[model samples]
Target chain A: MNTDAATAASAERSGSLLNLEAVVVAFGGLQALGGVDLKVWKGDRLALLGPNGAGKTTLFNVIAGDIKPTSGRVIIKGIDCTELPARFRPRLGVARTYQKTRLFRGLTVEDNLYLAQTGRSGRHLALLRSGVDAEFRERARAMAETVWLADVVGVTAGDLSHGQQRQLEIGMALVTGPEFVMLDEPASGLSRGERERLVQLLLSLDADITLLLIEHDMDVALRAAQRVMVMNEGETVASGTPDEIRVDPLVHSIYLGSEAGLGGADP
Target chain B: MSPTGAAPGRVQSRRTLRRLLSARNVVVAAATALALLLPLFGSNFFVEFVMTRTMILGIAAATIVFLAAYGGMVSLAQYLLAGVAGFMVGNAVVAQDAWSKGLKLGWNPWVAVLFALAVTTAVAFVLGALASRTTGIYFLMITLTYAVIGYYVFGSITPLSGFGGITGIDPPGLFEDHPQRMYLALVVLSVLVYVAFRVLAVTPFGLALQGIRDDPVRMASLGFNVSLHRTLAFTLAGFTAGLAGVFNVWWNGQIDPTSISIGPTLDLLIVAVIGGTLSLEGAWLGAFVFVAANNYLRNLPLVDHIGITEARFNTIVGVLVLLIMILSPDGLAGIIDRIRLGLRRLVQLSRGSGAGPAEAAAGSAP
Candidate 1:
């Protein structure tokens, strides 16, 4: 309703690489995702920004193969994953983190990393013989250390703080080396220190790891994502470089509004 | 020292399951060793009767534990699978009236037993598949329903079952009809099954089941076919139960549809619950409790007066189930774990106080 120009700047980068040409999804009488055409490349760090009711997460669900688009294709690495089951998407290197982070509540943090690893996943007999694969454990240890959670390996996932859980969830996704990782509101429940650490972590990741993040915080979204996609009422309103979308007359009232939120952040 | 002689002992108790030579395993192994050595001092009747029966029944209940612990399933039909062999073998052995009503597949006793296992496993696999999609009460109901169907089918299928119970089903002569000798055979079967399940409980796929138990939706999103893995867990459970069934027939030398009936199934569930749903050793202890309780209850004077005979054991069983469900939601194993944890904490606290107040307070601070 407010930032029409902010959405208009969304360069028509969609409908080319990871094509979702005119995708739509509706549940009962409610339209959740309406005719979205998004094209994402290998290095694209795109952010989906909207109010609480906007279908930012609904779009992430579509990309992660959790839900099927109503008459739209989802191609990953030129493989048509539109109708593939939820499990196969991860194998195709598409990973996701829930807005409400989901870690194995009962298992230790290290075991969570073990479960996330996609190695030695055969029959019971073979698993017994091979044990935990050494290579995967090494990879997991590296991922765990990167998130600054090396000390909490013995701690259960449920024991970790909310901010720590967020870090752990991201570490889990990173374990699999997903080609496209979709994170839903990583900055949602974080404190200032945690948010700063998260931003640094995002900035430190390799440019080749394509990220599609959804955050209501414009400042976090702008700092982390190279391009931002603005959604209003289940449709992409705008997509453009963070700088272009920031000063747009449409984005001003939509995101920053009368007040640009705490600490007078520039829109 | 609350003036009770049953005050806590100073000897350290092993609570954690992490240690290789912990108290639990040591106790279990020591008891098993005692059982194995019992035949030397005991009368022929003691060795021939109780010890023999304990090992045989132990094998049966252990099979049930494998499913519950690793797969996180409560299979009520485990004993029914074993009963198929039991009644069939018994009838073949004792059919003295005229001739035993053998299926006349003309196979050797061992071959016939193996065939029975194969058929039962296939049926169980199909049942497991149907029930695998559901969880909690719904899954339990599905498996229980199948147990009823199995019971009914074993009776009505006259082509294999005939009008009466299976007759002329004799156990093969490996034990030479010696009950104590049969105990050795049973001990072998029990050990094999235990080792097989123990190896699996720590394996990756087994850990996957734990993952599913924690959060199936998360597991699915992590690139796993949750249903398929659960079904496999069920099938493996069925397979072990079927193997136990083979031993059961040899032990009993009988066959009847009642082998797969609800009574035996419920017994398996009871054994699994009392043992502890989490650990492999839980079921072994559960089986010991089951045998001991059954023997004790049958001997009580009121069993006859209250109609709690072998045939009418349900009234008593229902009470026991209710008590266990209330008192031990995580079952006997969980109860034991809590006590051990309490002891460990006490020891830790006592040691901390010895270090003095200020240092002790800081050392144990969260």
Candidate 2:
């Protein structure tokens, strides 16, 4: 109801692609997101790092429209999409992969990408026309190749190794050609080589598509993201360039003081 | 670099149906040819009464399979949907007015059947819309509740269903007094419905429905409206059920209150599950099993020795259903798939490491 032109202008002028205004998520008495405010700018590769109970995923859920905030506004491109369900967000150029690999397991690698590509752009299917047209298959194949899955396009996602499944998860998110790609812990369970490949892949993504990811792997996260935001106890404790957050005393205490410490950081 | 080492046969089953000249397609074609020619070569009693009834019921059961297998919404209202068409047919043809037995339009059989189908489809959509919000057992419960309401409302309500229910409802002049012609018509209609279902099973809608079935949340994240897909699948299922309903009334020559009871409703689910909810062939298989059990099991000499008369046919069918549920929860389809997979493995072993597409195709027959 409050569609003020001034507020809209400020958000655009600030280069904010997503603006979360006083977003608060509460489960019974426990507040998962305690009045969090954040701005994700266009073409910004932002990494969200936090301790286990720091509400990083909760915040991601709120932005992704998977969870409704108790009270707040989620503005995407100056449009208040607070009430819009998660399914509608993809049309608005938002795509996300889950914390755990959520690829369609029964579907082949090509089929998974095919569904992702069609999710946002494809029209309501014609009854007689082939569901996966030549153009569609080509697009899916190209995407699979981009994700280093070209050779296994015919294989089911469930049969893929954990690392391959992760790659496929990212591929599924990117296949739709969304403006914002939110990946939750993309490097969580990969081998060192796989993580390095993942870092390279993230870095090579088109700059037009902004990236927001949550990662515990400090090395991978710092290498991939331009900016880093560390969360603690349902609040943004630190926000700066990756280098700045690396040396921030508050970030050190937050990381080192908690059970998930710097000692566990990947070499 | 294979993501999955298993053959492509698993995913291909849903899509392979499109190839008209494939081995599976050829087998289906041959079987259809046999079914069509049966009325000519076989006795009128077998073709007209038995096969005709089985195909009609098979079509109805297929509707259940469509919703259960693709949408993962195991609805119990498909038979109720068909019964809607039956009651509509009765209201249109035999009964003249509310003053008579039912809403007496006294229309021609063709017009009546069409009208009944349309009304049934609309009702199905309405039922779908209501049930789409629920999933799994909840969806089943909602549909079962509606089924109960429909059964009682159509059967016992004298105002809507005429005093003793509309009787002597016959097909058009072309089918009347011509059992073989009616059987042929039913076969043609049933085959057309099955073909349409097969075509739909390979379409985008069908694929999307399968995706939703696998992971509704994941499908939703991919921007597919899970509820909308479920509803549309249910409505499509309704269309087939309506066609079956029309044929059922034609076969029975009457539409009574008992025609839409819980017993018939449960039989629809039983037939579908017994055959294998995932395969289109399962519908006909289940129907054949059901009809055979009803016809022959009741008259078995063992039944008299067991102190169960011919009237207790359902008892035998019930036992068979229990056996199927316990032994193979996926029904006959699961059993058939396992057997095919085993044969493929055996053949590959016998050939000493030569695993060709031909062997794979032979294994994927079901």
Candidate 3:
């Protein structure tokens, strides 16, 4: 309802991608997300940082259309999509990964990536053989290489290591050529070396692909994202350049404490 | 470097050759040859009655396997769907006479067959939509309920189903003249259905169905219509079951309410499990074992010593099913897979080295 002139003008601009206006979600008596407003512009690498139970994942689900907000609007690419179901979101160029890895464990890495590539537009009922899609098969193999999984493309996903599964999850999301990608805690359960590689992968993404990351690792989040938004108890507490949020006294007290020694490092 | 490159090409060709002659392929080829040669035995009661019945029952059971193994839906309505086709064919093709009382449309047999398939598939789609809302045990219960309803409906509808069932329902002229032709036709159709199911498993639709079976929520999030895929799988299974129904009526020369009853419905489930729910070929193998036990087990001296007779045949089947479930949950197919794997391991050990690339390729075939 609070449509300010600046916000209205931004919504009309071609650069505007996702806009949430007073989005609220209530599970019976508990209010998971109390009225929240956010805007994501094209090509922006935005990090959503919040402590545990701060409703970050819940908000991510709302944006991904997995959960409908109790009230208010979800605008994606200048279109209202609050009532749209999750299956149709991919056609709108929206792709996401869950906090818990949701790869098709019984399928091979190539099959997993191929399904993602064809999920939005492929004729799922066609009886054509898997080898018939020579073009998509090539693209899936290329995606496997992108995620550093070229050697084990034929291996079942359930056999992959924890860090490798995380990489495959990202590869599935990117294979669809989505314009907006949301990754929920991509760095969780990853080793130090894997985390560094994840950050490099994130930073090297196409500039045209907007990324919305929910990460707990301060090192990965701060290094990969150019702009950061901090949330606390279901409200946006601060939004600015990553460096500004790192130095904010409120952000420090509520989220980053002295325990996170990497929080203040410039590197 | 030149010698190494030429050697690698030779090894690749050798691996390909080994893969072509893998154990699974050899078994399939041998089975096909045996089925094709079965007519040479001449028209005995065993060939016409027992073997033909096995193929027909196997086709019905294969539909059950398709849904359970690939789609993760353990439906009990497969036999009922087959009965639908049988009844439709009976009603559509059978001429009204003094003894037979029915619609007696007197339509051509081929037209009647297609109509029956369409009607049964439609019914399956509807029932599938209803069952797709539930999963696991609930799905089984719903499909069982449908089978029960079908039995009662057919039994109560005398004008159409004839409480006693329509008799003297003749097969098409081509099959009516020669019993061996019918048997051979069934064998050919069964083989085609098996091949089609195997091919479907690797298709995009088949892979997506497997994905939905494993995790419907994940499939939905990945932009797949989970409910649609499930319902379509049911429809496809229904069509296959309908074909079995048409064959059943032709084989028996009649369609009756007793065929769709709960007892026979569960028997089909037994057949599928014994064959190996995981392997399409297991359907026929299970059916052959079931038909053989039904026909010959009661005549054995061992059975007479044990005081078990033909009337208690189900008791023997129950014990067999229980043994299969306990020893090998995947059924006869699982047993076959284990044997093949064991043989491969033994060969590798006999060679006194780890598996070479060619041996490894052959080991993973199928």
Best candidate according to TM-score: 3
Worst 10 residues of 1 chain B by lDDT: B9-18
Model 2 misplaced regions, further than 4 Å:
A1-14, A130-132, A258-267, B1-23, B95-100, B356-366
Error (Å) of candidate 1 at residue B12 is 25
DockQ of each: 0.31, 0.44, 0.49
**Alpha-carbon RMSD of each model:** 8.5, 4.6, 4.2
- Highest-DockQ candidate: 3
Q: Model 1: residues >4 Å from true position, as ranges? A: A1-17, A119-125, A129-132, A252-257, A262-267, B1-18, B41-60, B83-98, B298-312, B353-366
lDDT of 2 at B315: 76
Which pairs of residues have clashing backbones in candidate 2? B95-B104, B96-B104, B97-B104, B101-B162
* Chain A only TM-scores, each candidate in turn: 0.87, 0.90, 0.92
Q: What's the TM for model 2?
A: 0.91
**How well is each residue in B149-253 modelled by candidate 2, as lDDT tens digits?**
998888667866877887778787888888788777877877887888777755666667777777778777778787887888888889789988988888888
Higher-DockQ candidate among 2 and 3?
3
lDDT score for candidate 1 against the true structure? 0.70
Runs with alpha carbons beyond 4 Å of true place in candidate 3: A1-14, A129-132, A261-266, B1-21, B356-366
Q: Candidate 2, after superposition: displacement of residue A162 in Å?
A: 3.1
Candidate 1 - chain A - TM: 0.87
Q: What is the C-alpha lDDT profile of model 1 across A104-164, one tens digit per residue?
A: 7766676677778752243323454343455565666678788888877667788789888
lDDT of 3 by residue, B40-93 (tens): 874577889889999999999999999988888899999999999999999998
lDDT of every predicted structure (CA atoms): 0.70, 0.81, 0.86
Preferred candidate (DockQ higher): 1 or 2: 2
